[model samples]
Target: MLREVVTTRYVTPLREGGSLPAIVEADDLGMYVVKFRGAGQGHKALIAELVSGELGRGLGLAVPELVTVQLDEAIAKGEPDQEIQELLLASVGRNLGMDYLPGSLGFDPVAFPVDSEQAGRIVWFDALIGNVDRSWRNPNLLRWHGRLYLIDHGATLIFQHNWPRDAGALEKSARKAVNLEDHVLARFAPDLRAADAQLAPMVTSEAVDAATALIPDEWLVGEPGFDSPDDVRRAFRDWFAARVRAPRSDWLPELAR
Candidate 1:
């Protein structure tokens, strides 16, 4: 389980994200950017954040530390904005919190030239997870302390949203062409073949199981067609394992032309 922290105060709302995440102070004396469970995206978004974020970290990517933030309904009483108050009240139990990067800058592909190897790895990783949000228009990446950090994985692993309807969709989706022409790193990703060779073997069943284990049981509960949280975990692990072992470069964006 991720470490749990009690929110001491809600500092301010970050209006940039559609989900309305906020900057909050916690009992641990650390500030976090909290993603509310009350958001329209629901608990599945939080599950994606944990699974994808941990996978990225395991693959040697820089990702923010995550925690389960405990929210109290009383915190909503002090908010003047009715919308924010409603959101807080609805998310009075557990929310997702990411370690706040104070001086980080949004990544701009034009201004920063990334090396081919790193770019290939990033593109490959995003492709493996079926991430559609890392395009140039809304690159969910940050440049902090001279390193790039991945964030906002709530949008990845989209197959989960409809898993109850189509449990077999993951395999089909994994083999489809990735629309990476608009990916922020597309132009810089010169050698995906090399990236696949280097990164694929690292995603073992043990690694996938360990990463999936970090997801909260509450988030896994109520998943359709699953008897328990462990069942859901196994489903995710199996999907990820299949993708890693049988990477379809045919699905990769045609950037080499």
Candidate 2:
């Protein structure tokens, strides 16, 4: 389970993406970028953030520490921004929080070049999770202290959104070809095959289980076709295990040499 912290104050709103996550101070005296369950993308987005973010960290990628933040309704009472206040009021409960990276700069391809191996691994990871948000136009990446950190995984594992329509969607998504032409790292990802060889074997069932274990029960509740949160966790683990064990070299997009 993720460490839980209570929000001490609502500092400011981060209006970067559609979700409008905010900078908040926690009782632990740590600052975090809080992703509210009340956001437009909802709880499923938070689930994706937890699952994919942890999985990336397990793969040796840089990911900020994550925690569950408890928000009190009283925090919204003094907010003058009507929209922000409404968002805060609606999110008065458990929310998702990422340790804030101060002085981090948004990734820029020209300004900061990435090595081929790292690029390939990042692309492969994104493909495995069916992430569609890491494009050049809005690369959800940050550079801090000369290391790249993955962030904003709320748009990943999109097949979960289709559960109400088709429970088999995850299988199809896992097998689908990833279009990487617009991926922020695609231009520098020289060896997708090599990346598969190096990273695929690392995604074991135990690793998958550890990552899925971080998801909160509240976020897993009310999921369609699942009797309990454990059931939902099982489904997620199964999907990820299949994706990792199955050969996905064919699913990788061709990268320019």
Highest lDDT: which candidate? 2
lDDT for predicted candidate 1 compared with the true structure: 0.85
**lDDT values of the candidates?**
0.85, 0.86
Model 1, 117: alpha-carbon shift in Å? Answer: 0.4
Checking candidate 1 for backbone clashes, the offending pairs are none
Q: For each candidate, what TM-score against the reference?
A: 0.94, 0.94
Runs in model 2 lying further than 4 Å from the true structure? 164-170
Candidate 1 wrongly placed segments (more than 4 Å): 164-170
* True-vs-predicted CA distance for residue 178, candidate 1, Å: 3.3
Q: What is the lDDT of residue 84 in candidate 1?
A: 98
- Writing each residue's lDDT as its tens digit, candidate 2 over 1-257 gives 79999999899899976989999999999999999999899999999999999989999999999999999988877788999999889888999999999999999999999889899889988888888789999999999998999999998887678652244665565676667678998778557778888888888778888988888888888987789988887777777766775556646677746
